[model samples]
Target: IALNAWQDTPLYNDKERAALALCEKLTLSQNIDDDFYLVLAELFDQPSLVTLTVAINAINSWNRMVKMFKPTVEFNER
Candidate 1:
């Protein structure tokens, strides 16, 4: 599935939304600071709108199944 956040959508353009979007992106993209993680954790604490939780869970599931430095064993094998 091609799951992605719709940044340009009007639903996400409100004042408080910019901070929330930044938090999600920072965590999704790279390592985050303690403060940021704290904020993210707090923001995601909500019981509604499970996008953040679902996104993290999906990425982690893919990460566990991902291969690393395999010398082309699956594709270019001899």
Candidate 2:
């Protein structure tokens, strides 16, 4: 999928690439350098950046919970 190989593919624009790069860094618990902060700031305002960080953290929390609990879902036919 394009998302799975976003780095190798050319499907994303500058903003998308920036957001994806931030997401990868946050998800992997990597250090965000000053240059990377400048890149993100160029693409997004403070509020937008905060929102994106919150969203990324929320998703990562959910993923961790799922991996730990291994919850299963079921569907019922009406």
Candidate 3:
């Protein structure tokens, strides 16, 4: 709920907001401009930034796989 309205809510700090913005842009295939990069750099160090990018990409890839495969789960009664 709060996350759905992240921009409006005050629950997130600057770093979280920046990360969320990056996630949204990456997920939506939107362009990440130089200014946004600067914002991210200011908020995170180089290694941290690389890790965040990798994590976001990994999640996106997993989402794509799930959508394409539509894997099912089966449960057994005890």
Which candidate number has the best lDDT? 3
List model 3 lDDT by residue over 1-78, tens digit each: 599999999999999999999999999999999999999999999999999999999999999999999999799989
Candidate 1 to native Cα RMSD, angstroms: 8.1
Off by over 4 Å in 1: 1-5, 13-29, 46-55, 58-60, 63-78
**Model 2 lDDT vs. the true structure?**
0.96
User: Model-by-model lDDT, in order?
Assistant: 0.54, 0.96, 0.97
Clash counts for the predictions, in order: 0, 0, 0
What local lDDT does model 2 show for residue 47?
Answer: 99
User: Candidate 2's residue-wise lDDT over 1-78, tens digit each?
Assistant: 599899989899999999999999999999999999999999999999999999999999999999999999899989
* TM-score to true structure, per model: 0.30, 0.92, 0.89
Clashes (candidate 3): 0
Candidate 3 backbone collisions, by pair: none
Candidate 3 stretches greater than 4 Å from native: 74-78
Ranked by lDDT, the better of candidates 1 and 3 is 3
- Candidate 1: tens digits of C-alpha lDDT, residues 14-76: 434635565466457756677865665665555433565566567656655664433433577
Ranking by TM-score: 2, 3, 1
Lowest lDDT sum, 10 consecutive residues, model 3, at: 1-10
